[model samples]
Target: MKIPRVVVGMSGGVDSSVSAFLLKKRGFDVIGLHMVNWDAQEEGTSQCPRSKDESDAKSVCDRLKIPFYTVNFVKQYWNDVFLRFLENYKMGRTTVPDIDCNRSIKFDIFHKIAQEKFGADFIATGHYATTSFGDFQQNRNDSQEIRLYSCADPLKDQTFFLCTVSQEQLKRAIFPLGSLQKTEVKRIAEKEGFHAVATKPESMGICFVGKRKRFAEFLDEYIEPKPGKIVLSNGKTVGNHKGVHHFTIGKRINGQYLEERSHLGYFVSRIDAENGDVVACEGSHHPDLYATRFRIQSPDWIPIRNPLEELPDSEILCRIQRTHPPVPCTVEKCETSRFLSVIPRIPLRATAPGQMCVFYTTKNECLGGGEIVEIQDTLV
Candidate 1:
């Protein structure tokens, strides 16, 4: 009888560190695999930020008496994840790169390497999501269908970012932090002598931005600035912008050329990428900033079946961003099968093309999601 081997994607973060430790305690032959998705040298940085992360990951693996290895996915990441992200921004759309990274690199390439190269039975991560296998993965059956579920902690649940993962990928995936809360994970890390990891601050926003103070400045390096008019919905030109790409829907309009004439700050309502026009609304709570209906590309359901076809009567919840709570939505078939129209019970704010609209059941099961293709109707 051989012990099942599992490769954990140790990211030097507390959540993943605790995941590797919990798996080892559960009797799996664990190995730590660190992925380098970016090369600092390409950005003209002398000191590679990943170097410290690699060292920390190695330290955790060494303390746990497990084999540690590092793989560079910089090329793959730039091609698959970063390129798509930049393309979306250039088109005046807000996209989630982490979702792309998971779809392309972490689950796809990392899974292949873990199983083919390491000869492992399973691959695990620190994601705060679970599957039909149950929390801690105690229940298992080869014939059973796998459905992604929200973690124990809703605030930390990461199922939104993982909606694109296929059934095959979710089948062999292990999430040790699924049943635990953020505070609990930190406590466990500290108890296990991972002081550095336990005390490390959480990583937020886009990873490629690093510690840059201005995100617009970072984007300017890649996208050429094309000055454009910032107009109100009523054809009132209140300001000018460096580029339409510099603004995102629902964000407050800010720049030197803008006239702050409104008592309420002006917020972006739309980006007309074709004409380089950025439309603004008067307030954060402006009706123009709230969307009630949108069209999305065909969804990638977890069980490989379109939920609209399988369970038409089932209640579906839609979420545009991870932080936003899932709201009741009605999915209607469009004229062409390539897209679907979604009408939420409550209007969603700041939704734009290129954002992923993840679906969920009332029971908290993630039904997968698709990229938002168009905003059909606003509250106004």
Candidate 2:
């Protein structure tokens, strides 16, 4: 019997390091593939640089006695993920680039290379999401569908980011850290003598963007800042902002012009990109912050062969943001086949445009997700 060759995405972090270690220990032909998605040299960042990650990844592979290769996906990430991210931000929508990066670069681009070039039967990552194959009666051939489930660690579950991954990609993907908690992973890494990365801090913020720079500073490098007026819901101009792209829905507005009302800490309700105006509302529970209905575009359903035909009038749980809990919702098909209307059982706050709305079964199986294109506040 031929040994199954598994290509693991090693980020030099504790999770990926332990993933590679576990796969190799399971008697599989494991190879480490480190993706270089960002060039830290260009940004001149000393904190959490890609070079350090690459070095750590290489070191882990050496310690594990496995072959390691670095693949540069900087151009691909910039073209596929970063470009779309900027476009969404320009439209004044709250975009999650991590979702796009997982869909386009890691599972799509890297998966292809791992299979065709590296002769890999499976590509594994340290993502905290589980994949299971289950029979689907909805299929004409009674085929099995790949279902994504929440990781054992609820606090660290990343099914939200993995929601955009397709069935085809999930079939070839493996997540070794799905059943383990962060503390357990650290213990295992330490026990296995991978001490350097066992205690390494997890990377935060955007993936490609180093920790040394602020998110707005990174965006300013690509997008020219357009000064805009910040107005209250009553249409009173209270302050000026650097750009509409700098603000997200529900984020508190802090500017020099609004010093008198600074104690109140007004929240952003809308971004008029065309006129360069950011609309603000008073409290966290402000009417403008809640949305009763929203429209999702290009929803990727997991098991259903035809989502439009199967999902109309269907009820499912919906998660509007990454960390937000799943809320009961009804899906109403729109006139256009490309869009679906989602009405939450209760009003949801900050249903920002461009953010993903992930659907799930009652049993916690991730059905898939779509980009939120429109929002309707019943109070408004």
Candidate 3:
């Protein structure tokens, strides 16, 4: 009998290492595909060196006795994910590149390559999210639909990063680390003699940019800094800032210019890109820092169907950031079907524009999400 072929995205990390091991152990014809999304040669930095990761991935594949291939997606990533990320920053919105990377590169492009080119039945990743299949719906031509669920490790659940993935993409995707805890994954790697990556530190911040340089410094290379005035909510000019694009909503401002107000702990309330000014509030709990209602754009509902009509009658939970706890909110359909009005039960701090607002069922099923287009100020 021929074993089904599976392609696993090896990121030179512990999770992916264990995923490849588990898939091979299950008697599947497993292959490792390492993606070179960022060109570290251009950046000329030892930080996040693509060559290092490629070497590590190759080492892991060799140890597991599996075939490994390196695929460069730098051009695709630049056009699809990186360009949009820069545009969002230039427009003064907090952007989530990880979400875009997963949707465009990992699932869409990589999944296509795995099936069409590599003759693989499934494409797997180290994502901490699980997939479930339901009965075939007769209405949709008797086709099964994929549903996304939170991982067993609540603290490491990554469903939020995958909210934009379509049903077709989910159908061919696999997440081997979904049910395993982070600690257990490490143990599996060590027990299997893949000790090189067993204790590797997890990557953080932007995957492409790494932590070698400060975020502000990295942005300066791409976006010219436009110095602007920092103002209070009441229109009091407090000081000057390097640029409106340098700050995110709800982030605290700390510099010599804010030295006097520093003791008050001022956080960014808003960014006026047109006027080139940043509005700040006195404290984290300031009324100006919170919003009870906000609007989202281009929401991609899971199961590939609209749940708008049902939202008005039921409360759905919304998460503003990946690590944030989901907050109960009511969805109000807007005049435009593409846009949605979300009213939280309580005011939320730093409902940053350009960030995603993921909706979920009470049972932790990801319903979908959209970009925060507008924020309603209930305090006024």
Candidate 4:
């Protein structure tokens, strides 16, 4: 029987270079593949040009003696990911495009294309994740099962983003860099003599579909900045804001314009978009971003009825976003719907809507997560 072929998603990055190299060393027929999320002509800039990244990826494939392929996923990305992102920001919600990109483009689009077009038996990425199986088989049933594990490098672990994968997809997805530290992976890549290994800086922040522009720039084009009053919590006016969309809860703003402000420091507490208002709360101290409990939405179903069903009530502990680790708490399922009332472990700051609040245990098992329900205008 022929060994199954694996197509590693190589983005001209060190991690992916290492991924393809390691798979080849393991005796699997491996190839490097790149996906073009945006066409350079669309943005009039080629910072992340499709042709360039593919060329770079192909160079590594040649050195590694492997086949390479390029796929155009631009339209799907704009419709499925970028459009959703724009809609979210319009509603005063901060969006995580990377998570959406992972769900719709990477796992869904890449996996399907690898299997059908590339004839790839398996798909791999340099994502900091794992392809563990026995971890899910404890139910005493299926012989073949796949469970995603945390990467050894806590700083780089992306399991939080992969939380949405279905059981079937999870089984097919492989993450070779999960168990190894980032340093070790870099060492392996250098030893393998792969080009672009040392200078492959990790991409961070938003996934703008290769649009090299700031959110303000994008939003300015699509959204009109309505002027609003920045009022203190005591109903005193401090200064004016360009728009409510420009500000968000928890962000501290300078109060140099305040005529007689005590601390002369202020922070965002509310964004009244409907009335074109951005309210600022004045104080000496800032609100803690940490919360003991928070409601999560867009939950990834865990095959069982729902993990939250295993909870004492419908409520569970949660961490509002990627900034902090998860903590313990319980919830009161809102009187009428999927909404949950989070009684946090402690009083914390700015649990903004549209931001994810992932749940985990003090024991560190990710109990799945969801986007935060709206936070309040008043400071706790």
Candidate 5:
């Protein structure tokens, strides 16, 4: 029996630690990877998050007695993901840097390093999603396709985030933690005797800038936060929001930015960067930000042979964001099932630009997903 080489992305967290341990147990060769995406100064810490994360990964690798490697991707991240993140927001469109990170860094760049440089057969992560063969794969389509499925633990499922992974990446990806619950993952890490297992807490918020008090402070380092006024759709100045950088479309409930009582718990309808104003309306009575008709372009999920059946008798259900619930929707139009306009059966909430719109079959097979380019009636 020969060992299949695999590279495990270890972030010094419990999930990735267990993933590495499990793959090794299954008789696969495991190499550990830590990506350095930001400078220590940017994180305002003695060391950057990725550096610390890599150290944790090194500890896991040491315990497992596997080779550990680190790659500096701060420049790449700045050009590929972070710049796009800032540019999109300046344009008043919300962007998901995580999606870009998957496209450019994790799958594209990292996959190349794993295969070409490390001579690895596969790259594994702690993501809670299962990689399986789809109908296209069974039938042997022109380009073999891969299916991404939700994890057993619905509460901790990260399938939505990984839906953008291409077929090639999917074929070479392993998610050992998909079948295990988060608690079980911790247990496995402990049983394996990995020290970082119990020490590190989960990392969250914009990768480098977590617990930094305010996003304004973070952006101030790069893009100066322009002072903005909070107003109604009619341009009635009710109050002043901190800055244009601090708001997104459809910020309801707290409405903390709108320091005025006239709003009745307002929702952010639109943002004007030129005028530096965020338009608001009553949250309850506001028109749902969820679009009845939305377009998805250049989808990564279309199988080469099947061609996505442009005019299907069936409709597609989509979740525009990871946290947002999926809603029943109809595909108004499809181009090789690539570009599609989805009309939801009911009103949805807070649809923003630069976010991922992930579609799925009722059986839980991920169909495909794309970025939100533009939104309608998003006036400021």
Candidate 6:
């Protein structure tokens, strides 16, 4: 019998290092593949982060006695993920680029390269997610539809970023760290003498931002500034903004041009791109900052069939942010098949266009999600 060959995406991080170690210990043939998604030159940084990452990944592979290789997806990432990210910011909408990077690059392009080039039987990652097929795909069934589930560590659950992944992609996915907590992963790495990985701080937010002075400043290099007015709900102009791109819904406004003064600082309630007006509301908990109902573009359901069609008007749970616990929501078909209407049992704050509304079953299964294209009704 041929031992299954599994290719693991090693980022020199503790989680991935442990993933490869576990797979190899299980008697499967393991290979380490590192992806270079961003070019350091583009950011004008003297130190290239990818160089250190590649070195660390290779070191892990050497320690494990496995082969290691690096693949460059810099171009693909720039086109598929980064460009779309800039477009969203330019349009004054907050977007998550990590979702697109997972869907288009890691699972899609990486899968193709793994199979076509390396003859990999399966590909694995350190993502804190699990599937119905099991974390290691030990119980994979070709006929049965696979479902994504939140990892054991709810705080680190990445199902939100993976909501866009298709069924086919989930089929071959292996998440070794799904059942383990971050502390446990680090402990395992430490025991194995992988101290560098175990002690390395986890990277957060957008990867390409990389040691930038400020997020807004990093964005300014690419986006041309368009001055806009900050106003109240009653059409009262309160302040001026360099651009709508710098602000996200529900985030507090910081500027000197505000003519209106309140004990509670102003927060963005809306971004009117056409009129160049960023609507603001006093207080973080202002009614205008919350939305109970919204319309989303058609969802990319993980299951083979759309659940809404299977059970019309069924209760579901949804969340916009990965860290937030899923809230109960009801779904309805819009007049046009292109959209779906969602109403959460509780009001959702900072719901904005370009943000993904990830849905989950009552049992915590990730049912997939759709990008929120419109916010139909607010708490006003």
Task: Give the winner by lDDT: 1 or 4.
Answer: 1
**153-254 per-residue lDDT for model 5 (tens digits):** 877878787776777788878888777888888777777887566657777667767667766677767776667788886778877765676777777624
Where model 2 places Cα greater than 4 Å from the true spot, the runs are 134-143, 257-262, 304-315
Runs in model 6 lying further than 4 Å from the true structure: 45-48, 311-315
Output the lDDT of residue 38, model 3. Answer: 90
Cα lDDT listed for each candidate: 0.90, 0.83, 0.83, 0.68, 0.72, 0.90
Cα RMSD, model 4: 3.7
Determine which window of 10 residues in candidate 3 has minimal summed lDDT.
133-142
TM-score of 1: 0.97
Q: Candidate 3: TM-score? A: 0.94
Q: How many times do residue backbones clash in model 4?
A: 5
Error of 1 at 101 (Å): 0.5
Clashing pairs in 4: 288-349, 292-344, 292-345, 293-344, 297-370
lDDT (10s digit) by residue, model 4, range 1-380: 99878889988778888888878877888978888886566554415545656777888889988988788899999899878877776666776777788889998989999999888877888888664542112222347444455667878877677666777677666677877898898888778776465566666666443455654664666567677787765677778866666666777664543444556467776666677666676553444333445555547753435666665633445666566655566666666566666676556567777776666544344555567766632234
- Which residue pairs does candidate 2 place in steric collision? none
1-380, model 6: which lDDT tens digit per residue?
Answer: 99999999988788889999999999989999999998878867523377777888899899999999999999999999999999999888989999999999999999999999888999999999999899888989999999899999988989999998998889988998899998898899999989888888798878898877668888888899899899998999888978888889999888575777788999999999877899999999999989999999999999888877665344578999987889988888899999999999999999999999999888888988999999999999
Which pairs of residues collide in model 5? none
Alpha-carbon deviation at 139 in model 2, angstroms:
19
Clashing pairs in 1: none
Give RMSD to native, each candidate. 1.4, 3.2, 2.9, 3.7, 3.7, 1.4
**Residue pairs in collision within model 6:** none
Task: Report the Cα lDDT for residue 3, model 3.
Answer: 80
